[model samples]
Target chain A: MAAPMKSVGSKLSVERPAFTTTSFQKKTRSKLVSIPGTRPSVQNGQLIVSTGVTSLDYLLGGGLAVGTLLLIEEDRYDSYSRMILKYFLAEGVVCRHELFVAAVQESPDDILQELPAPILDDIAIHKPVEQHGLPCGPQDSLDSMKIAWRYQNLPKVQSALASSSRFGHYYDVSKTMEPEIRQAANCHRFYFPEHPTQSSPTQSPMLESYSALLKSLQEVIHKGGFDGAAPMTKSRNILRIGLHSLGSALWGDDLCCRDNPRHSHALTTFLYGLRALLRSSLSVAVVTLPSHLIQNRALMGSITRLCDNAISLESFKGSERETNPLYKDYHGLLHVRQVPHLNCLVSELPDRKDLAFKLKRKQFSIERLHLPPDLSETVSRVSRGELAGAAMPGSACGSSTSGNKHLDF
Target chain B: MFTELNSILNITPDNFKQGEFVLISDRHTDGSFLIHHFLSFYLRARCKVCFLGLVQSFSHYCAVSQRLGVSLVQAKEKGQLIFLEGLKESLSVLIPKEPNTGSQALDFLRDPSAGLRSLYEFVRASVSHTGGVEGVEGVEGGVEEWGPPVLLVDDLSVLLSLGVSVGAALDFSHYCRATVCSQLQGSMVMLVRCEAEEEEDDGDEEGPERLLKGLTHQCSLTLQVQGLPTGYCRDIHGQVEVCWRNRHGNGQQMQKKLFQYKVHDKSASFFARGTSSAVL
Candidate 1:
C-alpha cells in the first residue's frame, strides 16, 4: 500500500528523483523534530513550542502546537495582551526561530524593542519567589513557633507553583531585551500603515490590510521553505508570527465600530484563510484581537471558533475588580476560552478555569486564582468561618507562604 | 465502529434515508466527526457519494476515513466517491494564475455577488451522472437498481467566511437539495457552525445564525453538536441535540433527542445523558 502511494506521488511531480529521495529522508530521519526549541507532545504527539511564559504554557497544555494559531483576546487597555505577544516573540528570538511580526497601530520594531529580557541564571530565576518571603523574614519563624505543637510538625505549604522540567524560560518584566540579542534572529515586519501593498481595490471580500497580511504570510512560509509540501533545505526552523491588535478600527475593520458592522465577515475570512495557510506549513501565529470592543458577540464567537486556541485577558485596570480587596494580589483574570483538539477527539483542558495573572516587579506569572485569607477580627464570625473553610486546603494563612506546587489545591 | 451512534441516529443498512436533508451543526465544539461518519457510512452502503470538503485537504479526509475502516482513495478509484478539495482550490482563487480561468465552485471568492451557482452545478453533474462506474450491481437492468446518491458537504459555513453571502449559501444548498434530494431521491448532509449565543440575542441575526436557521427549517434531521455548558471534560466530549422533522405527518411535529458522545481515535460512543463513566 505504501509503495503504490510513493509511486503515485513521484509520477505527479516532474522532479521525481529529488522528491522521492527527500520524502524518503523525511520519513526516516524526521529531522524536523530535532529542532532546538520544539518537542513532541506526550498527550497527542504533536510538535509543540513555548509561548514564552512558562505558566501560560502550562495552561495551554505544554505549548502552542506547530501550524496552529493562538488567538489572544486583548484586555481593555491592551497592555497585558501586548505583553504576551512580546513574550511570544522574545521566546522565538531566544530559541533562534524566524519571526514574522505584524501590527496596525504600533510598529513591529517598537514591539520588538519592548520585549522583556529572558532571565538566564537559575539562581535569579528563583529570586522572585524568595523575595516575596523576605518581608516576613524575622517574624515568620516566630509565628511558626506560636502555632500548635502538633501542627508545627506538619509540612511547610509551598505557595509557588513548581513548574515541570523547564522547557520555557522566565522573563524579567523590568528589563528590555538587549538589541544585540533581538537582532540574532531573522525577523519580518509588516506594519499595515507603511506596507507597500497599501490598499488595492481587490474584488476579494477580505479587507485590504487583512489580505495583504495573508499574502505576506504566504510568501514568508513558501519562500522561506517552511511549507511541508516544499522540499527541505539544508536546515529547518520554526516561524513564529506575532500579529497585534487585529479587529480594531485602525486595521480598516469595523467589527468594533458599530452593532451592525458593514463588513461582518471580513475578520473571519482573514482568519479562515490564515488558518488554512498555517495548517500546511511549519508556523504558529499569536494574534491579539480587541474582542472587548467588538459589539457583535456572535462575530467574536465565530472568530474564536476559527482559531485553534482562544484566550481572553480581562484586566482590572479600571473595572470594579481592581479596587476589590479580594483581588488585590492580582492584576487581571485569564480566561481559557478554547483549547485545540488536534488529531484527537478530546482536548487537554486546563486543570482549573479560575486562573489569574500578576505583574510583579521582576516577573510576570499566572497562578490559580485564590483570595487572601481574612486575618482581621473585625469581620463577622460566619463569613470568617466560611473563608477559613474555603482557604484551608491551599492557604498560607498563618504566614508560611511557601506552596511551590503549580496547581496546589 | 460507531454502532452506538448509528442506533441513536436510527440508521440501518437498508434505510438509506432517500429524499431527506440532514443538517449537522456545531457551536464551540468540533462537528467534523459527523461529516466523517456520514461519508464512510454512505460509501459502505454502496451509495454514490459527493463530498464538498471546504475545510481540510483530500489527504486529511482520506487519512481519517482509513481509520474508520474505509479507503477513500480506493472509493474514488472505483467511482464511488467524488471529492472536492476546497483548500487547494481556494488558494488558486485567491491568487489566480490567469485572469478568468479557475475552479467555478469558488467563483464567489473572485466575485462575491456571483454566489454558488457554479458549485451547485458541479454537485448536480456529479450525482446525476450514472454511467461511469456501477455504484450498485444491476439486479434487473433498471436505473432504480443503482444505489441512491448522497451529497455530503463537510461544511457550508466556510462559504460565508470566503465572502459568499448567507443568502447565496442558502441558495446553494437549496439547489443541491432540489437536484440530489427532490429529483434523484438521494440524501443531502451539510455541516454548519452556529454558536448557541445567537439564541440569547434575538435583536439581530448574523450570517451563520441566519444560515443555520434557514437550513434547520428545510432539513429532515438537524444534529446540533455543542460544547459542555459547564466546560471541557475527560469522559464526555460534547452533547448532540438531534431534531427530526416529520415531513409525512403535518411536517410540524419535531422529535427532539439529546445524547452525550465521546469520540475515540477510530470510533465514537454515544450514551444517555449523565451515563458516562466520569459521571459515575
Candidate 2:
C-alpha cells in the first residue's frame, strides 16, 4: 500500500476504532492499512511540534493544518528575508505540490534568512516586488490593465467559488495568490503578447525598450534548453508564515507618528486592517512587535489576535554578546523558561544575591530555574505565580492548554 | 499489541511484525522532527513508521532523516490517519527510493509550503494498494496516550524536540516520557537579526555565545566541543548547561542539551572527549 499523508484533510479519513469519548468527538477509524514497508499504528497519533516562536501555529495544535499554512515570519534585513523566502521558494520542499510565499513588507531576499540555517531550497516565495503593476508595453500595458480589472472583478468570481463550499481560515490570505489573482496579474501575458517566434526581437519596441535593463539580468532559460533539475522533495508538514517587524514597517510608513491617529490608534488601525485582510488569505499569521513600542493595551489586544501564536519579546539587559549577534532585538528573543504551571522567565536571578557581588553573579546557575519542559506545564506553574508571565493552568476554559483543538479537524 | 490502539485512534494494523513502528507525540514543537528522524532511521533498516502531526521543512526533514537514520517518507494529504491502518496490513517489503542525498544548503531553495502535497502522496499510496491485505488503524487527533501499530525502538538517539517554539522543554518531557527539572532553563529558538554588513565572521565568537538547543526538551546533560573536522561541532552531544538569573536574584542552571555533533570523519573517530560519538 502507498499513502501520501499530506494534510489535515487527509487524516480525516484514516480508520479509527470507535471508542467512548468523554469530551472531544474527533474522527476515529479502525482498519489495517499497509504502506510500502510499514504498518500504521492505531494506537498513538503523530506528535505535534511548536516552532517556539509564539502565537503562531497554535491553532493547528502548533502548526498549519497539516495540509495548510506554516506561519513563518519575515525578516527586516534583506539577506535574512531572502533566507526566509528561499525556505518556501526552492526545491525539496514538496515534490508533489506548487510552493508559494507572499510578502508585503519583506522582499524575496528579506525572507531568506528567516530559516534557522539558510540551506533551505524548495519553497516558492510569492513576492509583490515582481508584481510592480504588470510589465511595460502596449500589450504589456493592456495585460496590466486586465490584471487590475481582474483584481477588482475577483470579488464576484471568488464570491461564487467561496460559496462553492471550501470553508477554512486560508480563504482570504490565499486569495492574493489565487488563480484569479494571477489571471489578473499575468507577468508573461502583459509583456509577451505577440509570439516571440512571429515577430522579430527588434520589431517589438516595447520589448526592445526594456532590452538594456534585461541585459544586466540573467536571461531566463528558454524552453528546450538544458534546464536545472528539481531536487527530490520530502515535505510532510505545514506551510509556515512569518510577519517580521510589521508594526515597525507601519510605524515607518512616515517620518513620525504625530499626525497618524496617534501611535496607539495607528497600531490599532494597522492591525485591524491587516487582520481583516489576512483572515481568509493565510492559514496563520504572526506579527511581532517590539516591546518598547507597545503603547496601548487596547491596540495590543487587537494586534495579538492577528496571530494564533503570541510570544512577547523579552528585552536584552546585558551586552550584545548575551544575544545572538545575527538578528536585532525582538520580543520573540526572550528565552522562555518552562515551568509546570505557566510560562516563566529565568529573569532577575530570583531578585536576591547578585549585581553587588559581580563574581557570584557570573556563577549564576541555570539549574535554579526548575521548570516543566512544556509550555502547558507552565500553565500549571503559572497557577502558582499568577504574574504577567504565568499561564492559566488546567481550566475547562483556560486549562493551561493553549493549543487550539480544532486543528485536529 | 497494536490492538491496544483500538480505543485511541481510528486506524490499526492487521498484524504485528518484528520490523514495524508506530510513533506518537504530544503537542510539542519538535515532535515532528522526532517522528521524522525515528521513521527514517527505522525505515533504512527495513522498518516502517507513521507520523501524525506536522513536522519541519523538507530540508530539515531530509537533514534530520539522513542524520538520524530512517527510511525517508513524506506524506502530504489529510485523513491519512483514516487510511493509515489499512496500508500497513499488506505491505511486507521495504522499498528503498533513490538516495535523497541532498545537502542542508539545498534546503534554502526548497518550498516548505509544498510539504503537505508530498505527505499526501505518501499516505494515499500506502493505504489503497488495490489488492493488498488491509488492517491498519488510525488514532483520532488528541487522544494523547493509549492510541495503533506501535514500534518500541530500543534506542532513541535524540529525544523529541520543540521546533523553535516556546515550551520546547515541556515537549522534551513528553518525548522522553520523563520530567526534566532545571534551575536556570534558558533557551534560544527564534532567529536573530544579524546585520550582514558587519564584518564579523560566522565562527568568530570570541567570548561566550549561545547555540541552538534541541527544542522541546529538558537535558540531563549538555556539553560543547570546540572543534571537529568542520570547526568543532557546537553543542556536541547536546550537553551544554544554560544558566540564567531568576526573580529572587538567584543564579540558576538548567540541564538541557540543545544540539549534538556527529563526528563526520571516521578517521577522527579516535578523537573522543566526554563520550562524543556518532548521532546514530
Candidate 3:
C-alpha cells in the first residue's frame, strides 16, 4: 500500500517527470501501474541461467530484474546472502554470461561452495582475502578485461578479467598472452543522461567519457558491440561489473577505514552515478560493503532506495554472516540451508537464500524508519555540517560522497 | 556451508504467512510419539497442514503438498536444512485464494452425510490434484455446511495418559475458517484415537464387546513437551515427574514413561557439540 519494497520504474518515472515517452526504449516502456504486488517485467536479456526454480521470481515480484544493483545487507555474513549471489553465478556461467562479485572481507572459495554448480564458467569473482592476494579496486576490472581481450596480439577479453591461476582453463589465451595483469580500475555502471556535462562541478567530461565508454564498451564487446567498430576485439556475450568495497577503496591504501570521509563520499557518488548510467534494460550486478551496510542501517535505507528493484545477496561463509538481517528480508535469496543433502560445505550456483536468523535488535527499528527529511535541517541547526539524521542509520551516511577531490587517488 | 553456527532460518509466522507448521520434537521416545500423534491428528484435520519429520520427512511433505496443491518449502540438504525450498517463493497466484469461501465451517455442514464426504474428498483431491483444495471435484467438494456444530473434547483420561489431548490441541484448529467433514456435520467435536497394533477380536468395532475389551497393554511412550509446564507431576528416580506412564496394563489410560535422570551426564553428549544455524 505504501508502495512495494522496490521502486522499479521510479528512475524512469523521475527522469521523465513531465511525460511518458514510449519511443525512448528499444523494447521497454511503461506507465507504471503501482499495484500491491507488481509482476517484474521480463525480457530475454543476455539469456543467463533460469535460477533452476521459478518461485523466487514470484517473491521478487519477478525474477532478478536485470541491470539492477543488488544491495545485500546482513548484520554479518550468512548463508542467505551467499546463496543469493551464487544463484547469479549459475545464471551468469551456465548461460554463457559472467558475474563480478565484490566482497571486501571474504574469500572467493569461502562463498563459492554454497552454490549448487561449483564450476562457475560464467562467474568472474572478486572477494577480498588477506592471506591470498586478489584485486582490490576498479583498476582490477580494467586491467583484467584488457588482459582478457588483448592477449598476445589477439582478443583475450575473458582471460584478462579471469584469474591467472585459471589460465589452464583457457589454454588458447594462456599459451600466447602475458599472464601479468595490466591495471585495475574500480567501477560498476554509470547513468549518462547527459554526456559528461561540464556544468556539474564534480564531473570532468574527458574522464567521464573515457571511464563510461570503457566500462560499457567492455560489455558491449562482450556483447560483440565492437566486432565491426574496432579490430582486435573478440570478447562478447558476457560481462560482470564489480565495485568490491568501493568505500574502502576510496580510503587511501594507507589510512584506516574510519579516517576517510571525502574519499568514501566520492566512491559513493561514483557508484550512484554508475546506477544512473545503467539507464534501462542492460543487465548488471554489484556487491559491496555488506558488513558496513549492516553497521550503517539508516544510511543503507537510502542506499537500498538507490538500489531500488534489486536483489540482495549474503556471503554465507563470511565471518559474521550468521547475524545479518539480509538473510531474513531477502527470503533466503540463496538456498544455503539445503546444502547438506548435496554433501558440500559450500553450496553451488543457485543458492539464493541463507538460513533464517533473528536479531537481538533489528538494525532498522520502526522508529528509525520512515522518518521525515526535516531531521537533517534539525541536525544542521545544531552541528557544523551533518545531513539531517546523518548520525541515524537511515541517514544514508556510509556512502556519502564528500565533494572533496583536490587530492590524488 | 555447514558452519557450527546455530542460527534459525524460518519461524512459524514468517513475513509471508501462507501456511506454516513448526514441529517441536523432544528426544524422549514417549514424548515424541505423543507429540507426533497430536501432530498427525492436526495434519489429518487440516488439508493445509504438513508433517515434516527428519530429512525424508522434508521430501515427503514437499511431495505431498505438491500433490495437494499446497505450497511447501523444504530444504533438501543437511548443511542448510533450515532453508526451505518454497518458503520464500511466491506461488500464491497459482494457489487459489478464494476457493469458494463459505465464511463459516458450521453453517455449511447442515447436510451431515454429504458434508463428511465432501471434507474427505477435499483433502484427498487436494493431495491428488493441483487445485484439489478448490474442491472443483471429488469428496470435500461441497462448501454448503449441514449444521457442523463445534464440540470441545474435555476428557482428562485421554489428555493426560497419552501426553496428547485432541480436546486441548483442537483449540488451535477451532480457528479454521472452513473445514471438510460429514461425520462432524452438526457437531464440532470429533473422537481421536492413538495409533497402535491392536489384536482385533474378529469383531466389528460396532459391537459393545469391542469397547469392553479395554486396554490390552500399556503404551510404551512418554510425551515430553518443551516450554509446557508439568502438572500432576511426581518425583521418580529416573522419570520426569510432571508426566508419566500409567502402570496399569489393561487400564484404558495406559502409557510409557522414560526412566533416567539427566545426570550431569554426557550420555548423548554427541549432539551437544552444537549445529549450524542462520542468524540473519
Candidate 4:
C-alpha cells in the first residue's frame, strides 16, 4: 500500500500489508485487549502498561500507552535510571510479557539478571501503610495548629505507593528476581559487540549498530506475531523493549562529543524509525538516553519532542545538593518533561512539579518534595529564610515571602 | 477543510501564485496540525497534491482527513494525490537487502552522501503527468485540467536526521520549487522543525538553526507555530504566526499576523490574540 512499494522488489513490499485494517482495529477492537499486563486507559481508552514504577505510571497519566515509546533521560551517574529500567523488565517478567533487551556497553544478560524481585502485594502494602500511619497520629494533630493548618482537610495527598487498585507491583531492590521467574517469559538480546556489522563502502553516517538494532527489533516484532496485521494463531503477548544508554559514544553517535556534532541527527533518525516500528505493532519500549553528556541542548529537545513520553532524572551525585541538609531525604530529582497526549488534546500533567526520588535500603520510591519544616524555636526568621533560599533555588519567592513575614512581625 | 483557519491565513486558491514557496515551521509544540490544514486546503482547492509525509503514516493522514470530510483513499485512486510514506520506506531501506545500483529516492538510506535527486524526480514525474490527455478521465476534470500541481512536505527535518546534509535537503527543495512552482505554475509548501534558542546558547547558527534561517530567507511566506510563552492552558493549545514577505526591486516588505489556535478531532478553531475564552 506504500507508494515506493511499486518500484522496489517484492521482498521490501512484504512489510506493508495489503489491507490497512490493523489501525482501525487498534482503537476499540485491539487484539492487545487479550495481551497480559495491558489495560485500557479510562482517560482516552488507549491501551496502557505500567512503567514498573507505579508512581511513574501515575505521573504519566495511567501508564505508557501501547505502541508508544517512553524516554528516560538518564541522571548524571545513570544509577537510578538503570534501576528504573530493571523495574520495567521485572514487571514484564512478572506479567509473562516477552522482553527484548538491547545494550551497547553492557551485556543484555547481565542487565536482565539484575532485575529486582517483585514484592508480594500484601508485603508491599504493609510497609507503606505503616509509614502513612505513623505520620497521622499525635504528631499531625500537634503540627496542624501551625500556619499551614488550612491544608489539614485537603485530603492527605496520596502517597505514590498507595495504589488503590492492584494494577502494578512493588519490587524489592535488594533481591534479584529468581532465575525461574525471570526465565518464565521470552527474552531477546541484542548485544552490539556480537552483532555483525555491514561495512558498506558508501559509509552512511548512521552507525551499523543502529541499523542492526532496528532490523533485530523489526524481526522480533514480525516473527513473534506482535504485528497486528496478521491474525494470531497462538495467544498474543506484549513485547517490552528496553534499550539502555543510547546516543552515547559507544553507540557510535557523535552527539555527545562536540558542540556541533557531525552526526547530530543519527540518534534522532534512529528514534524516528524506531517509533514508527513501535506504532504499528503490539510493543512498548522504554529507552534510557545519557542526556547529560549530549553537547547540544537543542538536539536533546528534538529528541524529547519525538518521543511520546519523556522524563529526566537529575541525581545529586557529586553536586552540592547531595550535601545540602534540606535535600538529605531525597537522592535525586525527577523532572517530568513531556507526557503523551494520545487520542486527546491535553495530556495529564503531574499534579506537583517538585518531585524527588529516594533510594531506600530495599526500595526506590518517588515522592512529592516537601522541605523539612524549620521547627526550632531558637532559630531566627532570617536564618530560616536563608535556609529556604538555599534549599529551593528555583523558587526565589520562598525566601522573600518569609522575609516579608519577618518585617510584618 | 478548516474554513476559519483558511480565512485566517488568507489561503484563497487564487491568492497563491506560481513560484510561491510557503515555509511552515514550529517551535516548542506539535505543528503537524498546520500541515494537515494545508493538506486538505490544497485538495479542496482542486489542486493536484504530492505529499512527502515523513512524520506519520498514510493511514494517519487518511483517518484525520476523513474526519475533515475528505477521503484520501478516493483521492489516491483518482490519481489526484501522490503520497510517499517515509516511515515505511525508511524501515525497509534499513534492512540489509541486496545492494542495487539504482538511485532510488531512498538511496540515501543505503548511501547517506547520495543527494535527494531521485526523490525530486519522483515528485516531478507524479505531478507532471498529463492525465487529461488520456481517455480515462479526459472528458471530465483530470489532474492536469483541475488546478496547478502543489507539492507539500509534512516535514523536512527528518531528512537531516536520515544523514542527508542540510545543503542537499535545501537543494532538493530548491529543485522541487523550480520544477513544480516556477516551471509548472504551481506552489510549494514545506514544514521544517526549528529549535528554540536556550538561555545559555550564544546565538551561534548551525544545524537546525542554520537550516531554518536559510529556508526562511528563500521562502516567500513563513507560518510559525509556537507554544504559549507563559506555558500550557486548557482552552488555547498554541499560537500560529503567519508572515508574508513581498520582494519589490531592491527591498522586501514583510507583514506579520498572529492567532491563537485549539485543535479538535474533526476541525481546528483559530482566534486572534487575547480572544480565547481562557484569556478573556
- Candidate 4 DockQ vs. native: 0.41
Clash count in backbone of candidate 1: 10
Q: Which candidate, 1 or 3, would have the higher TM-score against the true structure?
A: 1
Worst 10 residues of 3 chain B by lDDT: B1-10
Q: Which candidate is the best by TM-score?
A: 1
* Local error of candidate 2 at residue B231 (angstroms): 44
Better of 2 and 3 by lDDT: 3
> In order, what DockQ does each candidate have?
0.37, 0.01, 0.01, 0.41
Docking class of 2: incorrect
Q: Give candidate 4 regions above 4 Å deviation.
A: A1-32, A120-153, A159-166, A196-202, A260-265, A325-329, A341-354, A360-363, A367-381, A389-409, B12-19, B100-103, B131-145, B198-204, B232-235, B248-251
TM-score of model number 2: 0.24
* Counted clashes in each candidate structure: 10, 266, 123, 0
Q: Which tens-of-lDDT digit does each residue in A157-215 have in candidate 3?
A: 22001112221111111121121210121123333333343332322211333344335
Per-candidate TM-score, chain A: 0.82, 0.32, 0.37, 0.82
Q: Order the candidates by TM-score, highest first — what do you get?
A: 1, 4, 3, 2
Please, what are the lDDT tens digits per residue for candidate 1 over residues A222-313?
Answer: 88888876665557788999999988999998889899888887888788777777777788999999998987777777788778899899
| C-alpha RMSD between model 4 and the true structure | 7.1
Indicate the docking level reached by candidate 4.
acceptable
TM-score of chain B of 2: 0.25
lDDT of 2 by residue, B81-193 (tens): 22122111101101111334432211211222122233234433432332113323334643121112222221121111101112332232233222111211111111111
Q: Model 4: how far is A392 from its true place, Å? A: 10
Lowest-lDDT window of 10 residues in candidate 1 chain B?
A: B136-145
